[model samples]
Target: MFQNLAPAAVDPILSVAEAFRADPRPHKLDLGVGVYRDANGNTPVMTAVRYAEQQLAQTQTSKSYVGLGGNMRFSRVVTQLILGNAEPTGWFTMQTPGASGGLRLLADLIAASRPNATVWISDPSYVNHAPIMRAAGLRVASYPYLDVASGGLRREAFFEAVAGLGQDDVLLLHGCCHNPSGVDLEIDDWQQLASMVSQQGFLPFVDLAYQGFGDGLEQDAAGLRLLADASEEMLVVYSCSKHFGLYRERTGAALVKSAGSKQVQGKLFELARRSYTMPPDHGAEVVAMIIESAELTALWHSELYAMRQRVQSTRHQLADALSTNGMEAEYLCHHKGMFSMLPLSEASIARLRDDAAIYIVAGGRINLAGLAPNKIDTLAEAIVRLAA
Candidate 1:
């Protein structure tokens, strides 16, 4: 049975990471991985999470299994954090390993419920999205998003692609801090998209990985709330990985919102019961404790603001560098979030890696979180040489 096994292609983003790791130069920069880094080029654990962990280690009670839905505390904490006080009835929720695990599990749930459905994703979305959706045996399609020409969302092309979406189709949207391309839909744009959801009848599936990494937590969740308000049914896969700096802890939850009768919710609950049976505990529990404590919650928000401010400052630095060198300003500083696609051609990507000892993805998605103030000039020099 194992004789026919084939080697698989490495993940595009991970491949770049591997290359960066193998590089021997000390000056080599890694704008590859989506993980956040401080000015000193380290992924630091947030203060609140550390305090929570210290408390947990000293007085934690049980190590027993957390149920099929993990901690109900996760549902409560995450719902309040991600969706505010809104109650979503007829919804089935389950905690999973992380956003990646949640995505895989959600796709599985979708497949079991509607096997033949086609899930739509942005053209250059999070690298893992398409493969996960397709691996679950769901057909995948792309809607226009980032424009290579302008280095931003192709607004016209986007609305056109969603123009004729089928009623039962699934559309994946990054709730905030859109990966790869930082371009986000404005509030009015979200209203239009919500209208499309209402008219077309497709489910709006949200991938909310970087909630506090964009604007403030509440401001970042605006689009999500807007959609939930417009949506009779929606699916949200929430991740605490980035926000809590709990990357290795694998903390996340899958929430399905529906407006159906009690009978339908019961069926959804049973479906979750059969999937992973239970979810991890430590990460979610820590998150719950932090959120529940007023002081910890404030500290968490403060830490989140620090990270957000740093990424935004990096954006301005890069944009100023670009403008200084006589390049267009249409896409750089104006964009929001942890990532920015520099409209670089595949060859430019190769050149940066080969010539400057600098590296980014072939599609040119750089994580603003991975950069520091000191390195901006070096990166800017490289970009100007290549693009200008």
Candidate 2:
């Protein structure tokens, strides 16, 4: 049986990361991974998180497991953070290892309950979205999201695709800060989409991994809040990794909002119980402590704001560089958050990696946070020389 196992294909994102790590070039740049880095090109720990950790290390008394649902206080605080004023009487939630784990848990729930449902994701979305959904035995499909021709959102195509979604389908939307493509829906666009969700009986599944990295915490959540208000039922997966700089801590939550029934809550608990049993405690506990304290929460907001501004600044700078090179890249300036996709072919991406020693994902997705401010011009020159 062991001899019959076939080799699995390597994940493209991880493969790029591995290749970047093995390269010894002094000037090599990595723009593939989706982590927030400062102007100095480092993923720093937020002051609030650091303080929380110090507090936890010194005062904490136990290393015991945090139940299948993790910390209750964490669940309550994080759910409040995500849903804002939305009523929780109709919602079911669980603490997961990370947003990835939440996605898997939800996928398992979907597969177990509605095995025939087809989960639709954006054409160019987070690399792992489809895989995790498929791994949990759900069928995955794509809807148009990007316009490669103009290097912007394919809005009309998106509406057209969703219009075709049946009642049994599940639409996976990037709550904000769309991965791979930083293009996000406007308030009006979200309202229109919510109308579609109401008209067509499909489930609205939101993946909110970059809440504070976009326009603002409240601004980024506008779309999700709209959905919650408009739809009778919805699914959301929240991630604290990026905003909190808790990448290694693996903190996240999965939420469900539907009318009157504790059945969904029971299912979520059961699903989480079998997978990982429970999430890690340190990160969520830190998050809860910080959010619970007004002072710490204020500090966390300031740090989150600074991180957002840095990424936005890098975006503007890169856009300026591309414009100077005679490329139509003003769209990059408007796109928010850590990532934006360049309209580059596979050969151009290969050339960028091989000749320029600049690493980017095959689909031209680059993490704006990964670039140091000083290297903006250098990257621009490389793209101009190679891709232009």
Candidate 3:
């Protein structure tokens, strides 16, 4: 009976967890997933979230369903965070299960808007990106990013990709904390993108998942805000999972900024009517409770800052160790996210998996959060041996 179905390939990013589960190596480090793990190797609950949970737990009123687009209050809060407070900008807000859900929905929406719209993605982009857009019936093309030579944004190459694109094409840009590959465009680069995006008339789509994890909450949002300020119309996918530490509750919003308020409201309604209407209440409530409460907001910011500092420190430590081990690559300091691209070959990746039980993706996009203080030496040794 089961023979009718063919073997299914696992999701590349998530498949790492499955492999880790089967491995018996006690010292093995799991750097595959894009989750935020603390120094102790656990993704701890934010202090604000804990407080919100306690408060909500004590006085929760109803478990009723929220019609398309979860809660109104939550959407407003999301709009404020992603779009910032002031604007004559037109926008729509739809809450999805998570950012993944929002991304899929946005792809579908874009496809529906203009069929076969070519989405320009970074060559070595987040693994799931191409799949989502391709599944939506849109074409995916790569622009050269992460020039392995310098391990930074290939700015000239990126502009070339944009230059060849049609006005209807969609350019998917990471607002902050680029996933898998952590190379972020500099402010001047973003300004150029904004001007180009405006001039070329190609649609802009922003994947903003890690807001507070990179530089700071507002600092990370700089690019997104810049794009929003420039574009007459744009799409932004929001994820509160990392920012609020609500991974499982599935809280995220799909935002579209238009030229006018009426257009924004209409698009929001239509988008809501077409897809999963409302975002989840639990996560939204938690975020709202935290943000609205001054004390909780402060606590959340502190936690976020601490987490940011830890990642930056770990990144420095990694680059230092790599240099000490006699390697001269310098992308570590420039990368601004939880992940980093290491200089590794296919044979080396395979060998590391087999011999050292050191797991990383084929492209070597490692989650910096997975490197604990103690495991750093082990990882450094593994890298040095394999690199040698």
Instruction: Point out where model 1 deviates above 4 Å.
Output: 260-276
lDDT of 2 by residue, 19-91 (tens): 9999999899999988877888888989999999999899999999888888888989888888884556677
Each candidate structure's TM-score, on Cα atoms with residue i matched to residue i, is 0.95, 0.97, 0.94
**Per-residue alpha-carbon lDDT of candidate 1 for residues 1-388, written as tens digits (9 for 90 to 100):** 9888899978898889899999998899999888999999999989999999999999987798877678888778898888887675666676887988889877876887789898999988998999999988999999999877777778898889888787658989999878888988888888898888887888899999989887789988998888888888888999988989999989999887876545444554565567556677989999999999999999998999989899998898888887787776557676777888887788888888988878798788898899988999888888879754
Q: Give the runs in model 2 whose Cα sits over 4 Å from its true position.
A: 85-87
lDDT of 3 by residue, 1-388 (tens): 7888988767877787788889999877888887888889999888889999999999998988886767667778778777677743467777788888888888877876688688988878888889889988899988888877678878887888877766778889888888767888878888887888778898889999988878887888888788788888888888898878899999988887765656555555566566666667899888878878889989988988898899989998888888888776567887887888887887887778888888888788889977787787678878888856
- Give me the displacement of residue 131 in model 3, in angstroms: 0.8
Measured with C-alpha atoms, the lDDT of residue 13 in candidate 1 is 88
State, as a TM-score between 0 and 1, how close model 2 is to the true structure.
0.97
**TM-score, candidate number 3:** 0.94
In candidate 2, how many Å is residue 356 off? 1.8
Computed on alpha carbons, the lDDT of every model, listed in order, comes to: 0.85, 0.89, 0.82
